[model samples]
Target: MADTTTGSTEQSTVPRWRIVGPGLVVAATGVGAADLVATLIAGQKFGYTLLWCVVVGCVMKIVLVEGAGRYSLATGRTIFEGWRSLGAWTTWYFGPYIVIWGFVYGAAAMAGTGLALAGLLGGLSVTWWGILSGLLGLVLVWSGRYGVFEKVLAAFVGIMFVTMVGAALLTLPNLGELLTGLAPRIPDGGLVNTLALAGGVGGTITLAAYGYWLREKGWDTPSYMRVMRIDNSVAYVVTGLFVLATLVVGAELLYSTSVAIESGDQGLVDLGVVLQDRYGEWAGKLFLLGFWAAAMSSLVGVWNGVSLMFADFMTNLRGGTSEDPDARAGGKWYKAYILWLTFPPMVMLFLGKPVWLILAYGVLGAFFMPFLAITLLWLLNTDRVPREWRNKLHSNVLMVLCALAFLALCVNEVRKAVVGA
Candidate 1:
């Protein structure tokens, strides 16, 4: 991998169209099974009425991610370094946040992958399949190189694109109604759901991993700025299409019916069954395959991207630069986080996620998007980023909108967590 510490002073001789590596990985990693389930539920509940929210959500992610990528390329500094520069509190928050977040997220990702697998090919229980999925991710990430990892993520994205989009097309949605959904309107009692669908589309802590992926892809300078923007925009466009397709499936398949899908990843399994009954075994199987791709892509993406972040965190905590060997992919700290994301979470699958851990995950997870949005608003506006590369007036407005949207989400999440506890 190229050194992430120093900006390449030399301009790239390569054409801009050729730059599409890390963005695809980050976008794919951001939209996992949970995102699919969320979109599907929105479609099921409100049909195409909230389709505009999906588009809005995609736009929000594009702005947020672009900010992150621009910070890295313009400053040639890791996001963690930028965060640490904010204050000692940033470190205090991120250290515990990552540890708890990874511990909970690993098991969840594994279970999600396993659920999809079990839905497609029966025999093993979801828990066992989840354990197996976790192990598979661990091995693949442990053994794979960054180039190979990107290729793997690309393959998963292909499968997701084809399967989910294909499934949506099969529904033969009403074009007029779909187009009308682009108009801003909310159904009765849809305020919360609308906010959620808009706020939650294609978001996760994985947003922070974009810069790390950029560094891994060797795009580490202001010369790569246009390419990074194009890459980010194109990737999110693909993501928006994928998410929109999922909504179409839900709207067409379940909107007229009284069927209710349970929440969480199992809701996807329920949707698969619905597809099987409504269409055929083949249709259901295809959806399950796409589900597996989505889950595994997240697994691999997190395994690589967030592990890179953790490595950097450890390096910075020790006063090492971003260029430290321990902070790069395949370094000891990087591998350590991969192991951390893979192994300890398996216990949660077998024994059930501890109640306290679930609560902590909820609270921490709630804070992250707001944390990211607020920090980006701060980082991109200051001298931390080059003036020319700083947030434009429109970019600041969108980012402020993003911050408010996510802060609302954070409040909702905290309320739900506390009430449920």
Candidate 2:
């Protein structure tokens, strides 16, 4: 499994700090504005009792995402191709889901980004910002290659990491309780909440986008595996800290204040107000700005990364190539999905999401992580990759745990959504 980049081997020597590439972008992309509000609410409602869940969530995703990148670099094959080797059913599940998910998710994500902007601009409504942000994503992705995209996203990660963590530091939380959160205990009635937080913290279908990002980053070979591992560890470590900081904010401010936060983006807005009251107006504004950066990073990330994913999916379906031409950003299939993601779903914005569509998205989306885990478990262990690069016993155990966690979380989500549990 190897790739020859556009330059000589000397170009491969990236700086340690600048090694934050696709993994960081994908991880940042996966954690949306809504997720921040969710984590904050969880912290507020339960204090840091759920903090361990965030760490678990990061670990679980690291296994899955690192596996995805390893599979690609080790096999010299696209994740779509790797999945195809498993069987046709992989294509079937991925095809419609990518299309439908792209349509609905584009609107939802843009709206989420827009909500954060609207919070900043007191008079502006979300719909206007949603349209603007969508167009901005379109233009940025349309104009740049993967390197440019990675740099911009990394900057956003910096903004998000600094402000949230800085605010958390200011609160001066109880160190003892914070340390206790590392012990992995589930508080009363917290079983479902713990699972949800564990599954939700920086975990999303964007994990699949890792391979595409790896390819884009020129890490398309087995030698890049060590670098990929380092890249992934650093990315998730940053994510873990961001999640911890959110937990700290929840524990220190909302928990003791008895502040009740609503679900969705408004909860973040309310949290911002709470920040203003406690830390000062600038603190609230800064938090919201950071919140917007986090949300928009995810937006730009998905807009660019997942569009690459859908392009590959479409290319594979038509028996076309995913490299050199069709797979590049601004290529035919990539732009097509970008349009698919940005435009058609606007109908949902006004008409309200059709119940069936919502159900399908939930059912399909809920099971994707399990699907990814199971597929990678099989794909990586096979001759598709050299034995040396294949999963060791310890890696397999982590993946098995990932599969089971996703399986349980999927069942919980399905039942909860369908039966109103």
Candidate 3:
């Protein structure tokens, strides 16, 4: 494992193509089951009319993540460290948020993986499969080797790329309509859905994890900025393709057939069955395999990534800096959060989730993306980041739009949570 605090990979000399590790991790982690369903449902409802929003969403993520990576390399501080520099309020918000988010998200990720697996291998029920999935994720990330972790995630991305893109090709998308979808026009009554497709799908807390992965990969200094940008751009380009292919599948197959999938992760399992009925059992099975890969990639990525963030949070809160041994990969704090994300959530798999916790998770989780965007706008523009690395005019513009869009989405999320409660 590359030491997070020590070691160097020659940033300038390394070929451009080789600088593609961390971004893949973020992309795979961010575009999980819920994201897939959001895009899938969008395509089913509006066909390709919402395709432009997918492009907008990709650019928004790239901007925010690049700001995060740039701040890390330029200031040589973790994102949590940068946040702490602002005020004590940052600590108060993040400390509780990470705890609650991990508890609920753990069960959600596990159930998503279990759903796909249950459809594929029916011996175990979804609850048992979910427990098994959580255990497997725990084991895989326990080693805390970023290299091994990245490789495993890449393999999942390969499966996702092949299966998803193949399904899109199988549907034979109409070239004229596909091209026309590029024009930005909202269908009547699609405003909320458009906002969601633009800012919600393919986005998550993992965007801020880019810097942590970059550090683990030995790209901690400003010299790595060029490659960091390249890595982010290229990885999200592939992610953009993945999202587009998914929307293509929805538009061509589901829309044309007037078919609608059940919402949530189960929608994906339902799609697999549709593939089986439309094509063959093999097509459906392969799609389910892709679905599992997507879910597991997210599970493992968060297992590794957010645990790193939580380690930093704990270290900082305790007066230790980011370089503290407990804050680094495989350290005590890192492993502690991994346990938090894995084991406690199993109780929810069998016993129902407590209402108070769900309410907390919903309210807190709703604010995160907007919080991230607005904070990046504040952090990158300030003197904390080196002058050369501070956000440019266009970067600031995009981030402002990101902040506003996410704020709207956050309001919608909070409303749903409140209504459900």
Q: Which ten-residue region of model 3 has the weakest summed lDDT? A: 1-10
Best by TM-score: 3
- The estimated TM-scores of all candidates read 0.96, 0.95, 0.96
**Candidate-wise lDDT, in order:** 0.88, 0.83, 0.89
- Please list the Cα RMSD from the true structure of every candidate, rounded to 1 decimal place: 3.3, 3.0, 3.5
Ranking by lDDT: 3, 1, 2
Candidate 1 lDDT for residue 45: 93
Off by over 4 Å in 1: 1-12, 15-17
- In candidate 3, stretches whose alpha carbon ends up further than 4 angstroms from where it belongs are 1-9
Off by over 4 Å in 2: 1-12
- In model 1, what are the clashing residue pairs, if there are any? none
Winner by lDDT between candidate 3 and candidate 1: 3
- Arranged by TM-score with the best first, the candidates are 3, 1, 2
Residue-level lDDT of model 1, residues 197-294, one tens digit each, is: 88776757888899998888888988887778778889989999999999999898888575779889999999999988989999999999999999
Better of 2 and 3 by TM-score: 3
Tens digits of per-residue lDDT, candidate 3, 1-421, equal 0002222456657776578999899999998888888889999999999999989989998888888898899899999999998899998999999999999999999999999999999999998898898999899989789889999999999999999999999998998999899999999988888888887545578998999999998889887887788788888899999999999988997887899998899899989999999999999999999899999999999999999999999998888989998999999999999999999999898898899999999899889999899888899888988677787788888889989999998898899889972
